[model samples]
Target: MRQMSVRRKRRDRPAEDAAGPQVPDLATKGGRLAILDDTEMARIHEVSVTLLAEFGMSDAPPIVAELVCAAGGRMTEEQRLTFPPDLVARALAGLRRDVALCGRLPEHDMALGDGAVHVGSGGAAPMILNIDSDTYRETTLGDLYDAARLVDALPHVQFFARSVVARDMDTDSLLDINTCYAALAGTTKHVFVSAAFPEHVADIAKMCHIVAGGREAFAARPFLSLNINHVAPPMRFSPDAAEVLVAAARAGLPCMVNTFGQMGASSPVTVAGCLAQSNAETLAGMIVAWLANPDVHAVYGARPMVTDLRSGGMAGGSGEQALLTAAATQLARFLGLPNSTIAGATDSKIPDAQAGYEKALSITMAAHAGANLITQTAGMQAGLMGASMEAYVIDNDMLGAIRRSLAPVEISLDTLCATMIAKTIRSDGHFLGHPQTFDRMKSDFLYPGLADRRSIADWQASGARDIRVQAKELATEILAGHFPQTLAPAVDATLRETFDIRLPVARMTKP
Candidate 1:
């Protein structure tokens, strides 16, 4: 009778809470949620389950499967398995909901999933710049350190992205995980990562140890974060990837399952198809993780790009780009989760006319669509390869402009008070020094060096500075004036010990 009473209370609670206003239709507001009907979502969910059960993920290693099974799952054929929800829930039962990324300023409590727009640097894989030379060389540890420093130095950089560089010892996949952790721990910034192996998950545990101080630190407040990239299309999760998802849940780490879709290839050629596919991918990963542990803290992140068949290239930023971005944002909200799409990307390699339009259009839509966190804010060129300081400068300026686009139009009496308008009513109306002029003009106006708003003669007199020129100049300013946080002596020592595999250089790296 006691056990029956407990279960009854649990069952009754969900029903009691189900009453509420229906979710606002994001699509009717020109958003993407309308693309996914309940029937289609159910169908895709079944497809993902079937794929996991029948095909299973490739090379999940018996060891990986064993840990899951030991945790009360049943594995039949290679990928055919079932997780007892009760057992999964027990593992995540102790998990927390919030993921607070620390900032250099102690007052800046950078929390994720709070519906605020938090921007950072992000990009697609496949090296564009030679990170070795810091100009044209392959990616290296020195560059990674400088990148972290640079990001830490920027006040608006809410979280530190792996930014760029391989920097891993011998290119072993396992080495990448902790290498990033060490870099993040050295700075007072939160990190974003691509954890490739499950064994490396323990390295993330070490990161949590360093940042949070141990299991208690993690349980109390987790600083460790992970990025899980779901397979593009004909979607499936790899066994190792599956293990990492479960690992994060067991360790109480927050993971963002990112979708990198290319239209007409991995998804339907239409925007609606892309939304359904993107939703399917995210829901599948979430379901797998949630079913494995309902207490897991994972967000749906979409990094989808369109494949240009004619050129055999991926379109980094363009008008069609937002179809994936805006729709994905709607999907995330539809499922009651946070969203991660992108900003600061361009399809053009050279910073030119095309790059300007593509980046501006796509980024504006991402903000208006309401992505909680957007990546690729800087250092993108040539469709996400070609990361450059010049590009980073351009992105920051561009982001400033795009954010303004999303600002709500002024319609309130506070904005259009007739009394204030009438107070300065003169025939000449030259109230330049009026009190309202000082108060209100500053709020609505943004002076721009990158955005062109000048007369023809004035423009010519100023040497007609294009965005690229401004970008280069701004990049120089950041390198010269921006200052990253100074590390604690003990933390500095640990950073050295962790990466002392090679000699350290205190200056810019050579190719």
Candidate 2:
């Protein structure tokens, strides 16, 4: 048995110096909810191990099968590669827990597997709600860049995962290269992108290396990671995606092996059954990556989606979806792996009241359940088929509130406030004018930037604009003004000369 030391570093917050009380670090305030007890979690793990040991996964890539076989996995008569319980256990134990998803800037970096939660944009939606026209259209490479910029500007959205697919690209290689380029150009924060083919992974890595100044620097703090869907659900490995996983592991890139199994369709109808199968599949991915390179940073992405039996479509906003995602987070934690799950993907077509409640319920539940990374927390809509810019702006405010909800109650003498209460009673008879009240205002409270909190009369006087309209205005303002200079001029020139970068430079800068 190989001994692996767990790296459990918490997310670093801005230091509090002479500068007034620092804003509380919301990422550190999760893991407060556990839907499954120890016995239930153990039972789920048992089922998953049994599934891998008996049922096994089919269609494993040649390299994956070879590596697994070398690591004690067996090829059955049915041509499925089965992992023994002991091999699965060893793989789980060998996984490096402290995986840092580094950003271009140090402050934007996120430390995973340390019991903290981070929410960011997700989905490779084919369509986007045009900010200028308020209509859904096929997403282009420019839309992907603009969406990344929106996420970069939004304070609450911590990372950028290529939200919309660039549908205008003619070829798979072009799509893969441009998608990665646009994301890197738009945000200095950590980025996640998918590779269409195994060969494209090297080109994307080369692009990242140029952005990071060299190969060694990029490897030390990789600003980009791959979100590989290695499994096709129903106990089968996607050949191309599995090959991409192998390539990513060898390249030393952080990879999130996402296994999205839709219940009642690709997986069993029951939640527990879906979880067990998804867990088995996710473990299989990790085992492959581990065998490829045990030092590779791999995040367990067990995203089990919900299916509405009546409509036979995805129910991304359903309460059942929230429960399943939260339960998956628990399962990941039980195995002590850095994990991510999908939430806030409302089935609503727009960012209306329905979108609000659906996104809030699912996102909040996942956060409380302590998912290390919660994707699709911003900009996803129409059951993850569309990305909305205005929705991203509105979801920022909602995520801020959710993060604040996770903040621990400070019970210090100052917070206890017996002295202040007595002083207020003896003096102004209210704490409204108190110094503590004024001092804690900025530090303790997180005021929404876009949410209208004014009086009804004031709102009416100001034209009584709804949240969607306000969000559109704000998003438009951000898109117009906030063009981040993530890449240096020299690096940009070199990249353009090297790869088929589609996003125009004029669009990345303000005119």
Candidate 3:
């Protein structure tokens, strides 16, 4: 494995240092919710092991099958590759625990496997909720770039992934290249993108290389990683996706092998059964990546969702979905691997009270469950088919609240405030004017940006705007001004000259 270069940019350091009161990167230290006990975890692991040893994986591509066979897996009569228990154990134990996903700038880097919580946007939504027209429309490449810039300005949104598809792009390869370009051009934060074909991986890599100054620099500290869903439910690998996974692993880019099994459809109805199946599938993905390259930085992503049995449709925002995803996160922790999961995906078509409550419940549950990386926390609505600009801003406030909730309560003598309390009672008769209160106001509490917190009279006097209206206004303001200058003029020109850079430079700078 190539060690990621952690050299800091000289010019960017001062600005990062001066960006006062850093959002403390936190983990759930105390109230770590675990739905699965040791015994249950053991059961899930054993079941997963059994499934791998017997049921095995089907539909592996020729390269994946060869890799599996080379790694001591056996081919069954049904043409499925069966992995022994020891193989799974070895892959699990050999995984690199302290994985640092390096960013273009030092401040954007994320260290995984410490149970630290990080929230970000997620992928592949086909439709966009247009605030201007008050209707849903097909997503475009420009919309993807705008969404990335909006997320970049949000303090609570830690990383920027490709949240919506570029429906305007005609070809898959074009889609692949342009999506990668949009994400990197929109945010300097660590990026996550995908390729349609294994061949397109090199094109995306070349673009990243140009942006990072050279191939060596990009390989040394890959600013972008691939989010490849390697498998369908019940341990079925897509041949094309497998090829992409193999290519990404060999390229030294970190891969999140996300397995999203819909309950009662792709997976078993019971939570434990769904978890066990997803675990087996997740381990299968890890095994393939490990076999391709033992040092591959693989994240055990479990995104098992629920189905509204009555309609037989996805119920991503349901309470059951929250509980199931939280449990899956626990299973990932039990295996001691860096993990990611879906949270805050509302089934509502619009950003409303239902969206608020559903997003809060799921996001809070996943954060409390010790998920290292939480995706789908912004923009996603209508059970992951649609992305909303207004919802992303509102979700930022919710994410801040979640982070505050996960933060440990400092009870040291300095924070104890015994002296300050006594002094305030004795002299001022109130703590509002005290130094400690003033000092801790911004540092301790998180104020919402879009949520209404005014009296009814004040609210009515201002504009009588609701949360969605406020969020839309804020989103518009942010979109109008927040053009990230992550790419230099020379680099941008080189990329446009070298590849089919679809996004015009003028559009990126202005609107």
Candidate 1 vs 3: which has more TM-score: 3
Each prediction's TM-score versus the true structure = 0.77, 0.94, 0.93
What is the Cα-based TM-score of model 3?
A: 0.93
Candidate numbers sorted by lDDT from highest down: 2, 3, 1
Query: Tens-digit lDDT track for model 3 on 351-466?
Result: 88899899999989998898888898988899989999998888888888788898876789988888878887889688887767766664666555556666787677776778
Q: How many angstroms is residue 395 displaced in model 2 relative to the true structure, after the best TM-score fit? A: 0.9
Runs off by more than 4 Å, candidate 1: 1-100, 104-108, 113-115, 124-136, 173-178, 185-187, 212-215, 218-221, 230-232, 291-293, 409-411, 425-427, 449-464, 480-483, 498-505, 508-511
Residues 120-239, candidate 1: write the lDDT tens digits: 776533454432234444555555555555555443445666666554456555356545643563346667776777667766676556555557766555554777774535455566
Q: Best candidate, TM-score-wise? A: 2
Error of 2 at 31 (Å): 0.6
**Per-model tally of clashing residue pairs:** 8, 0, 0
lDDT of 2 by residue, 1-511 (tens): 1111111111221123333443445655578788899899899889999999998999988999999999898999999999999999898889899899999998789999856899999999999887777689998999999899888888789899989999999999999999999999888889999997799999999999888989999989989999999999899999999999999999989999999899999999998899999999999999999999999999999999999999899999999999999999988998999999999989998899999999999999999888999999999999999999999989988998898998888788878988878878888898877777777775787666567666787678778789888788778777887877888899999999999887888888898
* lDDT of all predictions: 0.57, 0.88, 0.84
The C-alpha stretches of model 3 lying farther than 4 A from their native spots are 1-31, 418-429
Predicted candidate 1, C-alpha RMSD:
12.8
